[model samples]
Target: MSTVLQLVKRFREVLLDGVWIANTNFKDQLKDVTWKQAVIKAGSLNTIALLTFHIDYYIAGLIRVFEGGDLEIRDRYSFDLPPVESQEQWESLVNKLMSDAERFAVLLEQMPDTKMNEPFVAEKYGTYLRNIDGMIEHWYYHLGQITLIKKLLSSDLI
Candidate 1:
């Protein structure tokens, strides 16, 4: 398969549907999470809702750059999740994440293989491949945290 297609598949694996790596993707993990559960804090760890918003923040930002826009996302603002007080609000965030993830994969699949080696936005950001790989790794890191948080929330000890 082409490099771009491979990247798209890997991207989808983390955020959308594939389960080979983590045995669970964002869609599966967030499917049954209610707003209250999402917002419940596990010690000092970030809430599930905040993590969802954080990942989508980067994905949405990268999608803009892929579409020929500026890379405007900053790490400082990634976790600035608005209040998710109801099931509807939580679902909205999950829906946006899923949609942006799919869009990110689609945009990535359309990119030529040569473009992967090109700098992403600026040279400081590294190449497109690096950023994409970083995104996958980032999601997995949070996915692990979310998984543990969910487990913690479910246990009576929390």
Candidate 2:
């Protein structure tokens, strides 16, 4: 398989299926999680819903970039998920995340392997491969937080 395709597969594995190291994915971690559970605050940390939103927000911006659109997402606003008070809102957010993840993988798969070595945005920013891999790393980092927070919230000690 091509490098881009391989990367896309890795992305899918980490997000929706098990990967080599973690043996768990975002979808697995969120299994059976109700909307109520998603909004629960495990201590002072971010809610699961907020972290899900944050993960997708960056991918949304990266999709725009790969589509030849401008990247307008800001770090501060990335975590600014509105209150998911109702089940509908929570479901909507999750659905959006799933859709965005699929789209991102497709976009990456479509990218030529040669283009992976090109600068992503500017010389200082880094190459397409670097940014794409970094995105996966970012997702994994936040995935860890989400998993830990979920466990904390579900435990009796919480």
State each model's C-alpha RMSD to the native: 0.7, 1.3
lDDT, each prediction:
0.92, 0.87
lDDT of 1 by residue, 1-158 (tens): 98888889988998888889999999999999999999999889999999999999999999999999999999999999988889999999999999999898889989999999999989999999999988899899999999999999999978
lDDT string for model 2 (88-155, tens) is 88888888888899998888888899999999888897999998899898888888898788778768
**Against the correct fold, how does model 2 do in TM-score?**
0.94
Which 10 consecutive positions of candidate 2 have the poorest summed lDDT?
Answer: 14-23
Best by lDDT: 1
Candidate 2, position 6, lDDT = 81
